[model samples]
Every structure is written in C-alpha cells, then in structure tokens.
Target: MLTLKYFFEPNVTINYPFEKGPLSPRFRGEHALRRYPTGEERCIACKLCEAICPAQAITIEAEEREDGSRRTTRYDIDMTKCIYCGFCQEACPVDAIVEGPNFEFSTETHEELLYDKEKLLENGDRWESEIAENLRSESLYR
Candidate 1:
C-alpha cells in the first residue's frame, strides 16, 4: 500500500522545539525599531510608515527633543490588526522600522500583542544582529 511504503523510510518530522525550518530572505515576521550604533534612534518621526499602512495598525506621535530634533514620543503597533504587508519597513526612509526574523511572539492575551515604543525598541535591540543578517542575505538596503 502507498501508506506502507513510507514505513521503511527514515522519519522526516522535525522536532520543533529543537529545530526550525528556514525562513525566506523576504519573510516578514515581526516588527522592530532600530537604533544607530551610537544608541540614537533612527526614526525621524516623518510618519511615512503610518501614512503607508493599509491596515492602520501603526500609530506614532513625534515631539521635538531638547536638541530641537524630532523624535517619536509614542509609537504603537497593534499586532492583531496587522496584515503583515511589509509596507511599514519599506516606507521607512532611515530603515528605522524593520520586520525582524522573529515569529514566536505568541502571547496568552490579546493585550500583550499591542506593542508600544519601549517594546519595539527592545525588540530592535534583541534582534538587531539577526535583522542585519537577514537584510544582508536579501541584498535589501544593507
């Protein structure tokens, strides 16, 4: 039988906790906010990403810093409303917002899916190296 033919073959099932399938170079998993090597945030608060989101999941408010430079005061993303269209990353002029290689952001409550500025910045710090590698591998604005 067709079902019996596979019985003699080796198991191909992956142990998910210990192994994971490779994501494509173009894969957009989760959002992150990047900072410069000097620890300064890269977003100019231009609101380009906010204007470009079809799902209206991204919200940002910018204010002038002490140096009279613009910076975001509040940046929030509702992950539940996101369409994963990758537009936010594309619309960023300074490459401040990016979709990192993280897909394991599941939470027990919906409230946890609402990401604030602090969470986004933390995500950037956590995944910066991986994000850079993904960008370089994809030849995307590296």
Candidate 2:
C-alpha cells in the first residue's frame, strides 16, 4: 500500500528542535533598531517608520537631545498588530529600523509582544551582523 512505502524509507520530516530548517535571504522576522559604528543611534526621529506603518503598529515620540540632536523619546512597536509587510524598514532612510532574521521570539503574554525602544535596541545589538549582511545582500539587486 502507499502508506506502507514510507515504512521502509527514512524520515523526511526534520526534528525541529534538534535540526533547523533553511530560511530565505529576505525573510522578515523580528524588528530591530540599529546604530552607527560611532555608537550613535541611526534613528533621527524622522517618524517615517511610524507614518508608513500600514497596520499602525508603530508609535514614536521625538525630542531634541542636549547636544541639539534630534532623537526619539519613545519608540514602540506592537508586534501583535504588525503585518510584517516590511514597510517600516523600507521607510527608514538611515536603515535604522530593520526586521532581523530572528523568528524565535515568542512570548507567553500579549503584553510581552509589545516591544519598547529598549527591547528593539537590544534586538538590534544582538543581531547587528546578521541584519547588516541581509541588507547588504538584498541591496545588490537594486
């Protein structure tokens, strides 16, 4: 029978926790806020990301810093509301906001899905290299 044919063959399904699957170069997963090499945050509080979010998941508040630099006082992204359309990343002129290759971010509560500025920044720091590489590879065609 057709069902019995598989009994003699090896398992096609991968053990998820033990074996990882492949991902595409343009996979959009977790959101992150990047910084410049000089230790300055790349986001200039332009609010472009907030404006372009179709789902209205992004919220930003800006203020002038002591050194006369414009910066965001509050930047929050509601992950639950995000449609993962990559609009926020495209709207960012400075490449400050990016969706990193991190799909493992799962929380028990809905409140934890609401990412604050600090959480985004931390994600940025943690996945900077991967984010940069993904961006670089993606920019080659354009």
Candidate 3:
C-alpha cells in the first residue's frame, strides 16, 4: 500500500503595503502639468490635450497675457474621469504634461481628486525628480 504524504507550504506571499512590487518603465500613472526652466508653465493653453482626451477629463481655459502670450487660466483634470491613457502627454508639444510613476493617488472626496492648475503644477514640482529619473532609466533600456 502506497501512502501519500504532503508537507504544508509556508506563506510565500510578500507584504504588499510594505513590500511593494516594482513598476514597469511603461507604467502610466498620475498626471502632472510641467513647467519651464524659467518657472513659467509649459502649457501654451492649446487645448490639444482636452481635445485628444478620449475621456474628456481635461478642461482648459486660455487667456492672453499682457505680452500676448497665451496661458491656461483654468486647467482642470478630473481624476475620476481619467482613464490614464497618456494621450495628453503625447499630445503636448512642449512636454508640458506628463504621466508620473505615482499610483498612490487616493482621496476621500471627488473634489480632492479633481486637480486644478495649481494642484497639478504642485504635483509636477513635487514629482519632477522622480519623473525625470524614471524617464532617464527607461531611455537606457531603449
């Protein structure tokens, strides 16, 4: 008579919240509005992103400066409506907008997630280094 003996397996699962998995280079994540080196917003208020967005999550209102330079007076991106398609980043001619490697965007209210120009710019400033590093690291593989 043959007897089957099986040993209990140990828990091999990693602690996810503490030990997070690495993200791929192509991972499209939270959105940000970039700025120029001179501290001016990179967006020309062209509305290309608004038009190109399949979700229509982006809203842009433009106005001319005293020098006749166009800038976005009101730029809003509804995070609830965004699909993270990255089309907005691709549509931006001046690299004003980019998808950062941050997927931790969570809020208690929808209004908190609806990013305005100031909020987006702050995000860009905060995550600029990470975004640049990720881009550079990915460029090496390409």
Candidate 4:
C-alpha cells in the first residue's frame, strides 16, 4: 500500500546532466583565484590560505615585484589532497581565493588535478558572475 502511494506520487529524481539543483549560498565547490574589477589579481601573496589549509593542499610562493608590490609567483592547489573544508577561503583576507559553485571538475589524470595559478585565474574569469552572486547571497545571511 505504502509502496504504491510513493510510486504514484510525483517523480522527484533529478536529471543531473540536463538540470542542476539549487545550491545553497554557502556551498563551496571548485577553487578559483579572483581578480579585481580593475583586472588586477586580488591575491597579495599573504599566504594566509596556505597556513589555514588543514589538508595542506594549497601552496603559494611570494615575491616582491620591481614596483615594490607583493605578488604570488607560484600558486598551486592539489585538488586530490583537498578536503574542501573551506578554510582557505575563510583565511583569505582579500577574497582572492574562493571556492566557487562548480563541482564538475573531473579530470582524466591525477597530474591534471594539480591546479596552477593560470588555471585558477581562468576559472575565476569563467565563473566570476556566479561566484559574486554566491558571495552576495552568503553575506545576506551574515
């Protein structure tokens, strides 16, 4: 009787490929490096994210540029090692490093999962709108 009632009810299964379910405001997904509206990279090379990552997935190397501004020369994240604890995002004071709403980053090889600065910047550019919206939504509840 109960089985028949549930079977006759409306279908609730998600067609994951064709349609995506609504993500929460605090949903942390793929990691990305954000840039300012002026097109400059937001990371000041503070290395705070690196320090906070419990999984030790994040690594950053900083250097002082000729113009006397601090910048990161090497920024890498090992996605395989990451626990997605969102600590790195919270540790970033400049909001340079953020976990955006993109969890479909499956790779064919393990080496491909080691994200470099350029790749992260590309992800930032690609998902800036969604990332910003997610951040805005997150702030509303705070």
- lDDT of all predictions: 0.92, 0.93, 0.87, 0.94
Cα lDDT of model 4 by residue, 45-81, tens digit? 9999999999999989999999999999999999999
Q: What is the lDDT of residue 8 in candidate 4?
A: 83
Task: State the lDDT of candidate 2 residue by residue for 1-142, as single tens digits.
Answer: 9889989999889999789888777899999999999878999999999999999999999999899989998999999999999999988999999999999988999999999999999999999999988888899754
lDDT of 3 by residue, 23-130 (tens): 886689888888876888899999999999999999999999999999999999999999999889878888788899889988898799889999999989988888
Worst 10 residues of 2 by lDDT: 133-142
List, residue by residue over 47-67, the lDDT tens digit for candidate 1.
999999999999999999899
Q: How does each model score on TM-score?
A: 0.89, 0.89, 0.84, 0.93
Model 4 RMSD vs true structure: 1.4
Q: Judged by lDDT relative to the true structure, which candidate is superior, 1 or 3?
A: 1
> Quick one: RMSD of model 3?
3.7
Cα lDDT of model 2 overall?
0.93
Tell me the alpha-carbon RMSD of every candidate: 2.0, 2.0, 3.7, 1.4
Q: Which stretches of candidate 1 lie over 4 Å from their true place?
A: 1-4, 66-68, 140-142
